[model samples]
Target: MIDTSMGLKDMSKRDILVNVAVLIGFIILCMGGGGIMGAITRNDFGDRSEWYKALIKPSFNPPNFLFGIVWPILYLLMAIAAFAVWTKTGLTKEPIPLVIFFIQLALNFIWTLIFGKAKDLLASLVEIIILWLFILLTIKKFWKVNRGAALCLAPYLAWVTLAVALNYKYWELNPNMKPDYSWFVLKTEL
Candidate 1:
């Protein structure tokens, strides 16, 4: 937006550009955290065919490749929504909305670890439920700050709802799948 006579209150071109940059930066930060965590916990080659593929998935269950595409978009939307709230109440002052946002963000990563790394279907179901609630809370708080921001999270909430179904279906189908926590246990014969 080119502003010839720059009003004191009106945003100039530089302001607009700067805002875009900041928003993009916010998106990159969120995506980076999620991507890093996913990389850490993800199976080799990003294809868990040997593991997840072997399991019996429901008909509604999406192809694994779809997840690879969907998550980045969701993360971007989530970051934009959070940034909108952050603009209203920055880190300087303790903001309840931001607090909820961070909590949900942490839960997001935790869910990935539980499902992907731990391979605990039942536990993942429980954790995803908690994450969904936190996302709702964050959306409610964000709505008070910016309606568009809250709306941005709607897709995320919807996706998670679908994920809940998927998680439940997997849990129901595979009654014998348990997390292998033996890695943490020591094998001392003594």
Candidate 2:
């Protein structure tokens, strides 16, 4: 009986290590995916002040530099939220929520490509709406396992909501706006 108890304790320790490793792996994957996408769609404009000069922004728009500060922190929070879900329940059982999280991540990257690279304001707006929906679904699912996980994503959802509205305003104001290939050069001049 003592031997059997020892075996069970060993098994429990192994399980705990495995779960911790898995959570770390998930967090790394989430951050790595976002990093790769950011690299691929990186803006070439050096001065970033060019972003400010673009047509006319909504009066409520945050300063351009704030975007740089906001996104990295938000991405980190999202990865932690995902890790929370993974640690609570392995990926296989709660497939639906995991899938929704991935869908939103894909949508999130697509918006970056559309707005930052392709400069398609309307397309980015549509993508953000889809991203918002997926985030809501993922939050609902994660809440079942870890309410903290779900709560962590709330700020991301709120930011996307603001982004969607901003995108809509830009599209409305600059109906004929196209991707400015000269942005890099103009930024250098500034």
Best by TM-score: 1
Model 2 whole-model lDDT (C-alpha atoms): 0.73
What lDDT does model 1 reach? 0.81
Q: Report residue 178 deviation for candidate 1 (angstroms).
A: 1.5
Which residue window of length 10 is worst by lDDT in model 1? Answer: 1-10
Question: Residue 177 lDDT in model 1?
Answer: 84
Alpha-carbon local distance difference test for all models? 0.81, 0.73
Residue-by-residue lDDT tens digits, candidate 2, 125-155: 8888888889899899889878998999999
Tally clashes: model 2. Answer: 0
- lDDT tens digits by residue: candidate 1, 132-161: 999999999899977999999999999999
TM-score of each: 0.82, 0.78
